[model samples]
Target: MQTDKVLLEILNNRFSAIVNEMGYIVYRTGFTVFVKETQDYGVGLVAPTGELFAYPQEVGVANMLGMPMEDAIATIPEYRPGDVIITNDPYTTGGMCTHLPDIHLYKPFFYKGELICFLWDFIHSSDVGGLVPGSIAPSAYDIYQEGLIIPPRKLYREGKLDQELLDMILANCRIPEQNWGDLKALLAALNTGERRLTEVIERYGVETVKQGITDLLAYGEQSARAIIADIPDGTYTFSDYVEGDVTTQIPLRIKLALTVQGSDMYLDFTGTDPQIRAAFNVPTFGKTHHWLTVGLVTFLRTKNPSIPLNKGILRPVHTTVPSGTLLNPVPPASCGIRYATAIRVIDVTFGALSQAIDDVVPAAGAGQVAIVLISMPDYQSGGYKVSVLQPMQGGSGGRPVKDGIDGGDFSAGFLRNIPTEMLEADIPILVHKYMFPDDTLPAGQFRGGLGVDFRFQVFTPHCIVTARGMERHRFRPWGRKGGSAGTRALTKVNPGTEQEQNIGIIDILKLEPYDLVQIMTPCGGGYGDPLDRDPDKVLKDVEDEFITREAAESEYGVVIRNGRVDQAQTEALRHRLQTSRILKPFDYGSEREEYEWLWPPEVQD
Candidate 1:
């Protein structure tokens, strides 16, 4: 029996590899830049119980894993040999779609009439039919403006494409051709899942294959439990805020409380803010859903990349995101930019977990960074051209073990900025400057990483630039323990010039020729005491141009004279600075944080 269990675990990992390969195929073959470059998609193999048994490592959006495949299966009961169910519905599919832009598809696999598994994939389509080009707006207030809400329906009936549904979807979006290409790519990925699954069943009998899933989840549960157990069991709570709902101009709060007992951990989110009418609400259907857990999973991945991606990882943990809250919004509550709040939730979770397991968790990171879309009519092509003038992101705060990585990737691990050459080729724009912003990173023993700065000149006569979910502007990512706070975000036109205006939380910007657009991202928070930093490291940073001599004297109390460290002067300054500085907990966005005014941290705890 034990041998069978071990074999099942091994087979589970093998099948997981197959799904990962399938994910890569979808990414490589997809047409959209969002799919090809940013990799904003997910691939999973659902078990007989309708839960995901295997998910992709490269794919980072893990919250949608529990989205009920059973509801989708029942919606199209006429499941023949080859049929795929596709939908992006928030209500009918049980919060699977959450918003209209994401296109989701699933197909069941069978062996001798016995249903074995379901293949699932979803991608954030560039555009969907709506009042706005992106298929989301805070002002819209209703589902009608949010674009097409696809309920669970058969996209392929008996291996043949459903032409009517395809036509309807294509007619609604601005980029139909590109969307169709992505759909075909996803279909190919699902085919890969089917092929790989067939081999698993053949190699280790169908019964064993099913049992392997259960055992793998068990193993993950054990591993996650062990990780949780190491932290001294206690209840730690924290809360954070987003700028506001674009429509109401009211700030939103996300609350969390972490409870640990032995190997079991529970995340309670009870005092969170009420769900807004805006598109920023999180649609996590309660439980230890992916939105709140993926960051922890990302951190866990750094330690154990071999752990299986199954519901079992959630076994040692649980969540309580309330309905109509920021973490769990209701229908027609615009969730188009929901990931913004999700990133903060991840940050707060780390904040709370840091209390129990300081070494395992990391300091605050640049929350969520985004590039706005600017569009205009191209005279040469007589077509609308889109421009991503700048790819924005915040610096990663220094970790307990090491210095933070500069200009790090967002929540989606695979997200990478498009090269200047590619951006220029795709749009009518000239790249002026793209480099790390100086004097922005927080300084400490292990200095925080610096954020990016990008400046562009619009060549077009008229262009529309829209930005949403740009946080860390009013407040910065806070460090933990003795670390320091990070720098805030900023955006403007010719920042140092006379026309400079603080363009914060922009809905849209109309641009004219020779308009210089500048975006400065948030810097990472510094960890540990600055005085403890090695003088050699500070000198090196000065040489690397990551830090300035003025910063070394002011922030680190390190005095440098004639390009050399003045040991006696530095020692006296460090001693005085260390004694004078107050040893207080790092301030995240708390001064801007409203506790009872919105949601309580324990609400989601």
Candidate 2:
């Protein structure tokens, strides 16, 4: 064992740098805008045991830190120096690749006939053949409708590309040329990893490099356990719900009972609702999946960001997602939009942890990643021109110390929005308006973040629009302490015109030329009492147009007059509001309260 801490640290940094460099290579060389612009990809260095030993933190997908590759690797018969395995089937890959659109590739690195490590990378391809143009639809009832499911198989053999396999895979996709280019980019990244790992092995002996990997994992485990030990030992239970499944109007509940004891913790999702017929199922494979425990990893990162992000962080925590539930669904259940339910898992985790340590966790966030895709006839080209207009998301929750980030959702922080110029240039669309709405945020001592209001017009005729992962339209994001719940989402068509129409929670919409589409995202929940907010902060918010004068006075209990704070009136109003307020652990807004009244938690379970 390598007991030298300095040597291990040096090896760790070197290995991390290799993967980080590989990620940048993919980003720069990728052909599609999805990879180059949004960066919906991940790169990591995996051990022979299939656990991630070193992962890139600066680039690539942030939530794929603890993804295990054992199940996918074991399916292969043998491994050679230049052989690679490719898969995107969630069940066959053991949840390593959650959806089919994300193409995962793995290549083994050999050091003098001995296996050193495996290079792993995945990119969200722009289009895979399916019912919808984007290969994802909220109404999809089975996996077949999502896209093509590729099982673990050899994509390359003995440094040679499998032409037959490559051709077949590309033929099934809608955009064959683009998919082939992105696959090559992934191969380039894997090649970079191989060269870098070989150089490291040459400098330090293979044995020393292997020992350093073990030591780094141990260090991460130790750090994670130490942080977990700080929380008081207890079991905390919390429950939250998705507004509705795709096929049904009834809300689906996700329940969690988090048990923390000493340096170990266990999360049980036994009481969760059954899997829906829609595409909201999460394929966890009944293990400690990354999506089930990402909140803990995020919490640890917030406490000590210096810790290397790898699978070791998951050692101290365990998860139990019951079969037939939304988190762990059986085969044939569609998981096209699993990210929507994954965000709720994060919220429920935060809700449970807050009961154990109130000050550490934040309130509920706008828990959805609304993806808007537009497909129109391409007159220049023979086929249709399909492109993603925007992957719109809401804001983060308010913290005890500071206000939540405005117009920034934590769920898809890594996926950036396409630039306006690029969208207009590539597609027949015009961005009429894109800005935060005034007074839409929930009020508190540290108010919730503001949400976005986006309006655009289609310049092309016979355009079809599809929006997936829409939430917070009915039940709002709940607040904590005396803070208020955030606003809900809304969608409209041709607003301010005589032909204006309201489309509430739509799966797809057909449009003609000059048809306007407006999408309003939800905000995060606030933390602490609204009356405790500073008057100056309220005045500044009013001036910035994030909040109106009426909301500053009514919701926050802060009085503003002549563009300034009325200190005496504010103090009196705050005192009165504080006296009348009834504090609750959670404030789920009136909409949820009304729904819960009819269908209580106990009855649902």
TM-score of each: 0.93, 0.98
lDDT of 1: 0.75
Candidate 2 lDDT over residue span 380-457, tens digit each: 766778777777888778888999888876667777888888888878799998888876768888888878899999
lDDT of 1 at 501: 79
Look at candidate 2 and give me any clashing residue pairs. none
**Highest TM-score model number:** 2
Question: Once model 1 is optimally superposed onto the true structure by TM-score, how far is the C-alpha of residue 340 displaced, in angstroms?
Answer: 0.3
The stretch of ten residues in a row with the least summed lDDT in candidate 2 is 242-251
**Per-model tally of clashing residue pairs:** 21, 0
